[model samples]
Target: MTTITKDNITDSLLATVHPNGNSEAAQVIRENGFPTTKHEEYKFTNITKRIESKIQSFQQAKPLGLTQQDVSKAMIKDLDADVVVFNNGQFSAELSSLGEGYAVTNVTNSEAPFSIKDLYDDSYLALNKASFEKGVFIQIPKNKVLDKPVLLLNLVKANDGQLITPKLWIDCAENTEAVFIEQTVSQDEQAYLLNGSVEIKTASNSHIHYYRVQNQNNEALEVNNLLTDIHRDSTFTSFVLSLEGDMIRNNVTLNLLDSGCEGNMYGLYLLGGKTHVDNHTNVDHTKPHSESNELYKGVLADTSRGVFNGKIFVREDAQKTNAFQQNNNILLSDEATINTKPQLEIWADDVKCSHGCTTGQLDEEALFYLQARGIDKKQGKALLLYAFAGDVLEHLKIEAFKEYCIDLVQKKLGTNF
Candidate 1:
């Protein structure tokens, strides 16, 4: 079944009415159907089913217990940059401290968000825009180098049957260098679902680094949408790691508007105990001399399942374009399953593009080689899995964060290391 969701829903959502400040965006959601896993291109991860098809009413969510005195206490170790915290889709001003160089404000108060007004037309974005009572607007000044990363912390709360949605936007000015991090977590094993979106824009000659971590409650379900627009001579890199949530679906799209731009995307996911995680990526090369690369890997244990779909498109005038994509999966148990696909659509003959995917069980020969040497079967498998993930972990540049992710993967696989 594409979705095993609630067959009978009361549909308590507002009808042609206002929620917070967005009457126009709310009207769009009331007209178009809420995004459900039944929607094509979103079949594998059933987010709607996770929520049992009910829109939740908000109640001042506090996912990250942030306090006014957090500056002197409860600060994330080694994090010395601007930070914004959101609990249950509402922005926290005091818990979120802006850096000296950057300005963080409310979308209603800043022109930073309106700069990307085109996004308001998007059905999902419009839904969030209408319902979101509070959101963050971050602006990076031109010709500035914010050496430290800006962190956005999003926390989710599970109600046996509830639906929550959040919206976040990040913008980088011309000739600027910046990094953005988004982290999410949930409290308990109660069943719930989150639908969210993130938009990023980079001006000419600018550089941006984007990273996301999903650690929702064990019983939570998450559906995330990411959209990025790149201008001439800009560079962008994206990373995603998932270890929590019973089912997770991530949809990411990149648009390259001019020449001399480069984009790179990497993702790592670990699943166990009937968990499901799906990652879909699309790279659009609209002009010449643009390059893009993508690599995604997943490890599934017990009855867990995973899916990966990568698509690259090159317009007729997109000559001298270079694109590459690879998806690999390792199933540590017989019951595990994975669906992988790599696709390329190129109209320019002068372009260089390639794609491939692989799925298989652990190498029997290597497993026995180690088992024969007195290593237990479980330990041997963990060692091989760790080696497989080492390459992806190395691509993570943040030292402490990298180490934490490594430990997280190990813990997911029941390996202490």
Candidate 2:
């Protein structure tokens, strides 16, 4: 049995959406191929091995047209929101709705606001950039506040091994307020890989709320990258929830390019079985009087593994910056594992920065106290774990999603919420 290697990545690239001569993404794939155990960032998660096992499946998957019936299975229940559906990385107009003050179009119709050259350094991101066949561009009109959220759902209908690359560009105009929820689901149990990316540019005085949920089947592999540019006096908040997957990785980057910008990142991972989830986040403060906050929590059961590496960088010009980050986790079984690293780099003389991380099991004393109050041992443990993750859950402003997460946690713990 032969496995995938750097030498074969270029050959594999030819089977998909291969671009012509000297494309940056193609070049990056050739120079820096699949990562190995030696790569510092990928040491905890061996993506190369996972890809090798599912490489054939990805090559066999292809896009198919979707109908309303197929979209029905993935919609957010009871949520009054404008819905957009992407089937195998292609936008489906029959399943999408553009509300007032909103426009959704194909990227080919307009110029890309950001250059892909800047992102070519990252191999996975470059791969998506160079191979993505269909993408959507979204715009929110200036000063238009939406009464309902916009739901962006990515559904995988492939019955074989497949590769999916979806690209999104969102522009929030000045003084506009909007909320976006991105969710992924697959009806198929076959092995597949999803490489997705999002680019958001916000104008001054706008507020944007974004949420991402990965709930694919255990046979799927998903890697997602999100890049957000926050302008002066703007706020961008992102929340990520990872429920189930064979392997999942999320890379979120927030750049505060102007003064008086605020960026917030929050995430929760509930894992069981042999699942693996890794979150890598970077917040860059390039201007003065800016602030960023991040918190990620996880619950690992069975032999599951979770990893978090968060970095905050404050440049010399970013004086008067305040950055804080914290990561907390709970191990439900002795075999469960967690590797966390919270880092801060401050080059400014007048900035306040701090980072903290803790990984441990449920507090026995607290659990005992709850048990002494007539609560069963099972319920007590569940309550305690929920309380530990309550802080991050409170940050969610959407009631529908909050309720859904609560139900998921309750079901996973086999206790009532």
Per-residue alpha-carbon lDDT of model 2 for 35-129, expressed as tens digits?
67787878798876787766653452456766788777778777778888887777877788768778898764124556422322667787777
TM-score of 1: 0.87
What are the models' TM-scores?
Answer: 0.87, 0.94
Global lDDT of each candidate: 0.73, 0.82
- The pairs that clash in candidate 2 are 57-161, 57-162, 58-161, 58-162
Q: Once model 1 is optimally superposed onto the true structure by TM-score, how far is the C-alpha of residue 44 displaced, in angstroms?
A: 2.2
Worst 10 residues of 2 by lDDT: 109-118
Note the residue pairs that clash in candidate 1: none
Consecutive 10-residue window with the lowest summed lDDT within model 1: 1-10
- The lDDT leader among the candidates is 2
lDDT of candidate model 1 versus the reference: 0.73
Q: For model 2, what is the alpha-carbon lDDT of residue 367?
A: 87
